[model samples]
Target: MKYLLLLLPVFLFAKFASNESCKSCHPIIYEEFQKARHSHASLFKDPIHKAAWLISPDYKKKKYTCAKCHTPTDEKLLASFDYKQTIMPDINSTAQKDGVACAYCHRIKSIENNETQNINIISKKEHVYFGNLKDTIKNPFHKTANNKRFQNGNVCIGCHSHYRNKYGTNICSTNEHNELDSANCVSCHMPKVAGTPSNMKKRKQHAYHGFAGIHNDITMLSRYISVEILRGIDRFFIAINNLSPHALTLHPMRVMQLQVSVIRDKNVTNFKSKNFVRILGVDNNMTTPWKAKEIVKNTSIKGNEKRVSTYMYKLKKGDIVNIRIGYYLLSKKVAKSLGLQNNKKVNRFILLKQKVFIIKPNSFAPLQQ
Candidate 1:
C-alpha cells in the first residue's frame, strides 16, 4: 500500500489569485507587465524553455524542478498537484497564463537567506505587497511594505543567478548578482521612467516594469561591451571590457564570438576567431544540455572583467584589419538539436561592434610594391 501510495496522483488547490484579478485595480501596471518578457515566461510562449522541457524525460516524469522559476508558485501548494497527470496552471487557467504575474511577485515577503534560491514567499491571504519605496500609499487590494532588497539586484538572484540539475551539477550559473561590486540589476535592466505606477497616483519616477534583458533589444549588449585595438609589431591586441554589472552573456546557453578579418584590395580573409562559452554537460564529452556536470570552459567576460585577445599576423602596409564581435542567442548545434532553425526567438548573430584599423608601414620595414 505504501509503494502504491508513492505513485498516487496529487491534486493542487489554487492558493493564489490570478493577474486578471489585479488588472481591474492596477491597469497601468498590468499593461506594462504585458509588454515584458515575464508575461510570456510560461512554457506555452517561450520556445526555448518549451523545447528544453519537452525534450527532458524528467519533466515528463512529473519531477517539476523547472516549475520553480518558469511558473513559480507556492511550493507547498504545488506539492499537492501531480504535474504529469494534470496540466500546468499556466496552460490550464487564464489567470495563471500571465506568467510571473503580479500576485506571484508581490507575495514575496522577503528572502530567508543569502542563497540564490532561498526565496521566502508569503501565502496569498497575507495581501501584502513589497517594494523598494518606503513612502508608498495605501492600496485597497494589498498592504504596501518597504523591502530594501527589492531596490538592489539581489532580488533578481533567485531566478537569474543559478539552477542545478538532479546530479548535483549546476546546469546554469549566471552569477550576475555576485559578479559586480557596484550597480544592481534594477539599475540597468529596470531603469527609472517618469510615470506613476498607478493611474490614481501622481506622476513620479519609478522602475519600469518591462524588465528588459537578453530576450529584448541588443541595446544593453552594445552599451556594456567596449572594444579597443592596439597595434603591435606583427600582431594586434584586442581588448574587450565588460562595463555592465554582470557577465557579458548571463545565460549559460548563449554564446559570444569575436571575429577578426584581414581586408586587402577589397578582398576579405578570415584571420582568427575567439569563442566565449559557458561549458556545461553531464559527461566529459561536454555536449549535453541541461544535464551539465561541470563548467569546462567559461570564456565569458565577468562583471568589469577585461579580456585581451591577441592575433599574430604578417601584415602588409596596405592591409586593413577588421574586428567584429557578435552575440548569438544559441549555438548552431544547440539550435538544430532543439529544432529552432526558423524560430523567431532563435535570432542570428547580432553584430555588436565592428572596427577597421589600417596597418601603417614600419620605420624599419620597406613598403610592399
Candidate 2:
C-alpha cells in the first residue's frame, strides 16, 4: 500500500519531517491541524500568546523574538532567537510542542518585507512541500510544490500582514491598504471542508486545516461577517458588513461587539453597546504592548468596510429586533489587566453574527424561525 505508506515516516521519525511526521500521512490534515490557532502558536501553548509575551518589551532580554512566527519548528527556538541566547528554548520542545508546525507551513519559500515583521522564507529544499493543490498527489512522504503563495492569500502575508512597534508606529495591521487586491487569506481562513487530504489521496474535498478564527472555528468565521437592520423613522441603523480581507480585529487584544435588542410586548429593551476597538497608548491612556507608542484610539472595522451602528430605538408594529455581532479575545478590561480573568477560553464571548428583525409595515422581516 504505497510501500507501506513509505515505510511510515521512515519508521517513525528518522525524519519524514515532523508534526509527528504528518500523523501517518496527514490524518485528515492532522485532525484539522489539532484544532488550529496554528496549533496554539507557541510560547508554551498560547495563553493569549503567553500573556502578551510575559509583559513584553522583549521579555527581559531573553529575547524570544516571538520565535519567528511563534516557534516555527524550533531550531532550538530559532537558534535562541538567533544567537542572543541566554538559554531558554525547552518548554518540553518539539518546537514547544509543534506550535506552527506541520513542516513549518509547508516550507514557505518567500516573503521578507521587514521593518519588524513579515519574513518567512523557509524552504531550504529538504523534502519539499508547498501547496495550493492542482492535483497534488505525489508523495512517498514529501515533495509537493505548486505555491502561488498558496493560491493567492500570499500565504497569509508571512504572519498576518503587519506589526510595527519599535517606534515606526502602526502596532497592528492586517493589510491596511497595501491592498494588493486583498480578500483571500486562503479563501477566507482555509475553508473547503468534507475530507480526504491524504490518507494517500482519494480526495473529495480537503483544504480546511481548522484555522477558522476568533480562536477556533467560529462558526466557520460566520461567513465573513454581516448583520444589516436599517429601518429609520426615529433612528435604527446597525449595518456592519465587513466581508473580510482584514480588520475586524487582528489582535491589539481584539474586541468587536455590537449587541442591540428590543423585544416589546414581552419586554426586553437592551441597546447600549457598540464597541470595536484598536487602542494603544502612552499618553491618551490605555497602554500595554510594551508601553505602547501610538494608536491611541480607533473604532476599527475596515476591509470592505460597512460599519453603521446608529440605534436611537423605535420600531414597534411587532418589534423583536435583536442583532448580535460579537468578538473579544481579551477585552474584559483586557482580561482584567492580563491576569486573563479566569481564561475560559480567553474570556469567552465570540458569536460573530446574529439577527432577528421583524418590524414590518415600513419593512423589516426575517424573524421567521
- The models' CA-based lDDT, in order, is 0.67, 0.76
Model 2: per-residue Cα lDDT over 1-369, one tens digit each: 999998884454332166877888778889888888887788777777887777787777767778777767666545556667775656775667887788878888777777667788878776888887776767676678866677675677777777777776666788644574345777767878887888777888888888888777787877667777777678777778888767787688888888888898998989778889998888888888656888888898977788777878678678878888888888888788868898787777889778787787767532331
Candidate 1 lDDT, 179-279, residue by residue in tens? 53235877777777777777656757777777766556456447667777666677767788888766676566788899998888998889657889877
Query: How displaced is residue 135 in candidate 1, in Å?
Result: 3.4
Candidate 1, number of clashes: 1
How well does candidate 1 score on lDDT at residue 97?
73
Off by over 4 Å in 1: 1-14, 21-29, 74-77, 81-90, 113-117, 123-126, 176-183, 261-272, 313-324, 351-369
Against the true structure, whose lDDT is highest? Answer: 2
The TM-scores of all predictions, comma-separated, are 0.79, 0.35
Worst 10 residues of 2 by lDDT: 9-18
Model 2 steric clash pairs: none
The segments of candidate 2 whose C-alpha lies over 4 angstroms from its true place after superposition are: 1-56, 59-62, 74-77, 81-83, 86-99, 104-139, 142-192, 203-207, 214-219, 223-252, 259-273, 276-285, 289-314, 318-351, 354-356, 360-369
User: Cα deviation in Å at residue 200, candidate 1?
Assistant: 1.5
The alpha-carbon lDDT assigned to residue 158 of candidate 1 equals 61
